[model samples]
Target: MMTKSDDEFLDDIFGTAKAQPTLVPDDLMARVMADAQSALVKPDGAPKQSLFAGVFDIIGGWPSVGGLAMAGVAGLWFGVSPPAALSTWTAELIGVPVSVDLFGDTTAYFAETQIDG
Candidate 1:
């Protein structure tokens, strides 16, 4: 007959405890999941929003809508009537001479000459 040493016997007992499967009741897990789902809240007790309404809320309600409208108007106004100094100011900032006229492009020529000198 073979016999296990004291250390081997202790190790076998502890190893079985480590390998044992823990059984949780199915109803307990269901109750836990339900509690978790209930804990994830919707703001102001409101029900779910439609897709468009959700997008509108994500874009920050009314103020962002007004700002977007104003930006569109400003872009249209600028495209129709550009300021005269816009050309000279852009020329100075870019370190080149530019004519406000778009008929014959020569800005690249001036830029190359200035860069070489």
Candidate 2:
């Protein structure tokens, strides 16, 4: 079930199951040994926590709940107020007065100009 050509091809790829020797320069070898010693010198062998965890810890320990209170006030204002409330607020902000009455017929305070060429 084995072919000679396949066996030779496998041997060419895997180097006939023999380990090849490696060569290293004396100066480069000394430098590599020094670097390995430095890499192994951990203070207590504990893994350092990432910067993301530190940021999350600070945000989680924030002292104020002002944001939550503001959100609740905003929700209450939007839910209980009428749609006309926003328009009246805008008019008041721009120094204009607006009146709304069911019994009174509404009229434009100013006349519209008809442009004729």
Candidate 3:
């Protein structure tokens, strides 16, 4: 048995390959061109939104805005005055004593300094 060279193999494959011309209907070509043109062109007075506005649009718009606002307000409230139950639970979980003072010794030290001055 004789082995064929790489060039001979490729030549045999290409020798059987034939070039064929594809014919598309004129109306189909016209419609395709019209669609391509329409996609490339933008309509007049179309307002371009900023990145933030685009993100808000994708997140259900006004409802998402209201949700974000509510979350921020809730975070502010929790930071100012966290519930005693929450503080106690956290202290117990961390194996630490729950002090009655919210600001701890830092606030007391600052108050004493102000009084002395």
Best by TM-score: 3
Q: What are the lDDT scores of the predictions, listed in order? A: 0.86, 0.72, 0.85
Where model 3 places Cα greater than 4 Å from the true spot, the runs are 1-45, 97-117
Q: Estimate each model's TM-score.
A: 0.37, 0.26, 0.40
- Ordering by lDDT: 1, 3, 2
Candidate 3, position 81, lDDT: 99
Clashing pairs for model 2 are none
Q: Which sections of candidate 2 miss by over 4 Å?
A: 16-19, 42-117
Worst 10 residues of 1 by lDDT: 96-105
Q: Report the candidate with higher TM-score, 1 versus 2.
A: 1
Clashes of 1: 0
Angstrom error of the Cα, residue 20, model 1: value is: 51
Ranking by TM-score: 3, 1, 2
How many clashes in each structure? 0, 0, 0
Native-referenced Cα lDDT, model 2: 0.72
Error at 109, model 3, angstroms: 25
- Residue 44 lDDT in candidate 2: 83
Q: Candidate 1 residues 1-117, lDDT tens each? A: 545687788899999999999999999999999999889786877677899998889999899999999999998987898677875776678978546777456888888899999
lDDT tens readout by residue for model 3, 69-114: 9999999988899999978888788978645867877988999999
